[model samples]
Target: MSRRTAVIALTALAPVSWGSTYAVTTEFLPPDRPLFTGLMRALPAGLALLAITRTLPRGAWWWKSAALGALNIGAFFPLLFLAAYRLPGGVAAVVGSVGPLFVVALAALLLRERPTARALLAAIAAAFGVSLVVLKAGAALDLVGVLAGLASAVSMSAGTVLTKRWGRPEGVGPLVLTGWQLSAGGLLIAPVALLVEGAPPALDGRAIAGYAYLALANTAVAYWLWFRGIERLTATSVTLLGPLSPISAAVIGWAALGQALGPVQLAGMAIAFGATLAGQLPSRGTFSPAERNGQELSVDPRIPAVRR
Candidate 1:
């Protein structure tokens, strides 16, 4: 495969793995400990990456890494877990599906990329399709859960745009950047999890295996791919792939979790998947106006500064 296609496929794996989180949490992990689960998913994986990379942030990056971590991991995780616990079925997924719209607007404002009509429409269609796939006819929504879902979406959206805007420091690979954010975010979650949830719950073999999968596959590696993709692709394209999470969730629910998928859900999946594919199409040229004019745009990090 071409490099761009490979990046897209690898990045797409992040959300696809994330789609299994609900099932893993419900089936194997302890109950009513969203903070702890978030902690487990982030901290160990982060520390592992840090050890492997053996790189530390310098100067401004220390703060930048911390900020990005808070938005993407610390804040996003607990909120996401809260929504999953409180909101039944697809309500949380539907709420979170608005992320692309948030990214589109943020990119326009923060990244100075013009929003394309296709992106706007795809975001709407993806949300609607996800709602159909996951939202039950009368799934009662908790007010707190809805708010949490919205907040998580916003937090992650902001994190994504900021990641794209900042890019990585010279000589810092996505592995190092991923480690920094995960560690920072995990540390942030540690105190709150301790305060709110008290002690960590004892883990059985099932829970241990679940947490291990979450930390390694779902979080550490997945986030590395995600950040890597962000370095190459437009923020809009990256976030648009988020719909796959719910669609994957639904499929897993059917095949693994014994949840049924009716005709409507199938149609919804098709629509959402279609929008996801469409979102990957290039928006104008990848280069910004300044770059096209043979001028450097602000910071030129080690990563190729492609906006699309």
Candidate 2:
């Protein structure tokens, strides 16, 4: 595969692994401890990465890492859990699907990446398709849940855009950057998890295994790939891949959990997948440093330009 294609594939794995979280949580984890679950997913993974990398954020990155941690992990986890608890799963999934739209708008303002009409349409179609895949008719919406879901999407979107805007410090790879954010985010979540959930639940072998998988394969490695992709790809392109999370969830539900997929769900999957591919195609506004500052410079001629 070409370099861009390869990067995209690796990045896609993050969400695909994330899609398995629901099944794992329901089957193996302790009941009704979303905060603790989120904590386990984040803290151990972060600390492990920090131990492995042994690189700490310096100067401005100390706070930068903290800010990113809050947006991407700390705030994101609680808001996401709140929405999932309060809203129907379908409603929550549909709200989260709007993340691409949020990323598109933020990329325009923050990263100076222009938003295309095609990008907007693809975002809308992705949300519609995810709704079809996950949404149930007559599902009720809780306003707080809806707002929390929206906020979570915005938080992650902003995080993605900022990551793209402030490329990692020279000589600092994504692993170190990932370590910083995860540790910061995990630290932020610690007290909240304690306050809300009271204490960590005791874990049996199954739950321990589940948390291990989530911390390692799901959060640490997946986020490493995600941040690495943000370094290489446009923020909009990265966020557009999010539809795969729900689609993967639906597929796993069918295959592993014995949930049925009807014609409408199948159709929705096709549409969403098509939109994801469309989002990857070269468009008018690829990432350009000049676009941000109205400078006359262009991206390096040596680096192959990623299409919008």
Candidate 3:
């Protein structure tokens, strides 16, 4: 495969793996320990990546990594778990599907990339499709859960757009970038997990397996591919892939958990899947006046520069 194709496939794996998180958490993870679960998911995988890469952030990267880590993992994780716990899996998935819209807006404000009409439409269709597939009649929604779900999407969307805007530092690879963010996110979670959650829950063999999978395959490998893709793909394009997570989750629920899917759910899945494919199409026009005139959006200087 071409390098670009390979990168897209790899990046796609991140969300595909993430789609399984709902299942794994509900089945195998210790209950009532969202912060602890987030810590385990991030820190060990990050530390492992650091060991393999043998690279440490220098100068501005320390803080930059911390900030990105906080947005992408540290904050996103606990909130995600909270939503999952309070909301039904479908409700949470539907709420999280709005991430692409958030990314499109943030890209315009943060990266100076005007939102394309096609992308906006795809985002809307994807959200509608996900809602159809996941939202059930009479599903109760908790206010706290809804807020957490929305906050999680915003946090990750901001992180994604900022990642693309800054790019990576010269000579820094995605693995290292993934490591920095994961490590920083993990560290941030560590204190909270202790202070609020008290201690890690005892794990059975099944829970241990679940945690291992999350740390290695889901967080480490998946994030490496994600960062690698962001370096090459437009942030908006990459975020368009967000809908796939819910689709994957829905499929897993149907296939693995034997959750029955009606005709409407199936139709919804098809629409969401189509929207995701449509979102990947290349933008077909010249740069907007703002971009042509070097009016690129600038992030706060306090944010560390990314390697490009």
Candidate 4:
């Protein structure tokens, strides 16, 4: 595969791994410890990456990493777990599917890229498709859970756009970036978890195994791939992949858990998957004259180009 294609596939793995979170959390994790769960998922993974990479954020990156980590992980994780705890998994996933819309808007404001009509439409369709796939008849939604779900989406969307806008410094790899953010986020969560949750929940073999997977594979590997993708792909393109999380969750439910899929859900899957593929296509008529003439497209001067 071409470099770009390989990068895209690797990046896609992040969300696909994330799709398993709802199932894992509900089945294996201790109940009502969102803060502690978030801390465990983040800090260990971050520290591992830091050890592997042997790198630390310098100067301005210290604060920048902290802020980004707070938005993406510290704040986002607890809210996500709260939503997952209160709302049905499908409802929470459906709510989180609105992230692309937030990304589109944030990209315009943060990255100074004008939102395309096609992308906007795809975002809408993806949300609708996810709702069809996951929303069951008589699915009860808690008001706080719904708000938390939406807030999680918005928080991550803002982080995504900002990450794209503030690309990594020269010679810094995505692994280091991932490590920085994860560690920062973990530190942010530590005090909060201690204050709110008091003590860590007791873990059996199954729960320990689940947390291990989340820290190693889901947080470390996944976020590394995600940050790497953000460096290469447009923010909107990255966020468009959010729909796959719900779809993957639904498939896991069907195949592994024996949850039955209805005709409408199947159709919704097709539509959402198609929209994801479409969203990856480069926007037509977006290339500047230089790009049209076979030169590299110019990035916004405000946003630093990521060095490969």
Best by lDDT: 1
lDDT of 3 by residue, 20-85 (tens): 987888888988777888899999999999999999998888888998999999999888878888
- The C-alpha stretches of model 3 lying farther than 4 A from their native spots are 1-3, 284-308
- Model 2 is weakest, by summed lDDT over 10 consecutive residues, at 293-302
Residue pairs clashing, model 1: none
Candidate 1 Cα misplacement greater than 4 A, ranges: 287-308
* lDDT by residue (tens digit), candidate 2, 117-194: 989999999999999999999999999999999999999999998888777776677899999998899999999999
| lDDT of the structure predicted as candidate 3 | 0.83
Better by TM-score, candidate 3 or 2:
2
RMSD of 4: 2.9
Q: Per-residue alpha-carbon lDDT of model 4 for 1-308, expressed as tens digits?
A: 65556667888899889888767887888987878888989999999999999999888898889989998998898888788888997789889899999999998887776899889988998998999899888999799999999999998998898788777766777899999999999998999899988988778999999899999998999999998788667788888887888888889888877888999999999889888877888764334454444443324446432234
Candidate 3 scores a C-alpha RMSD against the true structure in Å of 4.6
- What TM-score, over all chains together, does every model reach? 0.92, 0.93, 0.89, 0.91
Best of the candidates, TM-score: 2
Give the TM-score (vs. native) of candidate 4.
0.91
Tens digit of per-residue lDDT, candidate 1, span 183-299? 999999999999999999999999999999999999999999999888777899999999999889888999998999999999999999999999988667454565545543333
Clashing pairs in 4: none
Model 2 segments more than 4 A misplaced: 284-308
